[model samples]
Target: MSNLQQQLNFVLEIDRLKAVYRQAMVKSDNNRFENSAEHSWHIALTAQILSPYAEDGVDLQRVTTMLLLHDIVEIDAGDTFAFADQTALDGQPEKELAAADRIFGLLPEQQFIEIKSLWLEFEAAQSIDAQYAKAIDRILPLLQNINNEGGSWVKHGVSKTQVIKRNQYLEKSAPKLWQFVLEQIELSVEKGWLKPE
Candidate 1:
């Protein structure tokens, strides 16, 4: 096989990413929460739906691609929550970054660089796309928590205050979505997903 074909073959094998599927806090009606694949697709669709709400100009396509590819590292390194305490989230970038290099490097070099750049951009939240993508990244889990009665938040002992803090940036980038999230938080409490604190 040609070098190009080898890279293509590596990319085509979807089995590499499916070692385990994590439920998104709440079980879906199907008794399964969304997996990383569905999460990726959802964010891409979110970029399309929420582009107009982005506070700054964003390349929705780029944001979507970044969201779709960003979590592949989690396949190897496992996902650490964004609101995880400092130690859980910190001083461990090396492991995940190296994993990103390996998994993304499996693609052609240009794709590796571009995807890596997008992931970095999403992390830095420096660009409009990055910031908007970050909002989606944070917002989706909150939606799951609300829908599933605080699935992860309840499971992980997270407080409503913590959820609000993690969500505050949504107000800056996507006020409309942020408003919806706030309402959802209130409803989750009313629905007994969150015990009032």
Candidate 2:
């Protein structure tokens, strides 16, 4: 196949991500759960909108690209809930890596490497761009859960401590967003949506 054809094939294949439902509900959609594709789009846009607040400067374009591609592997490996217990998370890394190899390999060599690298960078969450992208990524679920009256947290019996630990990266990467998350947690607890630990 031509490079253009291969790129198109990869594009068609990733449309599957829209079918992969996530555990978090969408606030504007009558409490229906969101899919990975919607999550990707929202976070990419959020990263752009919130880029000015990143303490460490980042390339907004790179951050948006990272956010968009980060979860494409979930199309194959499946969405892993952030609140899921460790037992449910066993072998997830292996599964996602295999999925990445197969999916990103569909693109032409150069595009494949770039897309795959973006995915890996987001997974590592090490670079300033990746860190900011990750912080934006983490914010969505918390926002959705709060808006839905602790949607997944209540369902999974998640405590404040677990919530804090899960999102601690934001404290250093995006302090303002971290402050907003802290306030949301406090309100969620006050609203009886989360148990204090």
Tens digit of lDDT per residue, candidate 2, span 1-197?
A: 99999989999999999999988888788878899999999999988787777876778889888888899889889998887888889999999999999999999999888888888988998888888888888887888788777898998888998888877878878889899889988888899888898
Q: Estimate candidate 1's alpha-carbon lDDT, on a 0 to 1 scale.
A: 0.74
lDDT of 1 by residue, 1-197 (tens): 56697578657743455553554643555546456776777778877887878876667788888788777777677766665788887755777788788777777778778888888888777777777788898787777776665787777767667777777777877888889888887877777676566
After TM-score superposition, the amount by which residue 87's alpha carbon in candidate 2 deviates from its true location, in angstroms, is 1.5
| lDDT scores in order | 0.74, 0.87
Deviation in Å, model 1, residue 177 alpha carbon: 1.6
Candidate 1 residue spans exceeding 4 A from truth: 1-3, 23-26, 195-197
Instruction: Give the range of the ten consecutive residues with the poorest summed lDDT in model 2.
Output: 49-58
Task: State the displacement of the C-alpha of residue 81, model 2, in Å, after optimal TM-score superposition.
Answer: 1.0
Question: How far does residue 26 in candidate 1 sit from its true spot (Å)?
Answer: 6.1
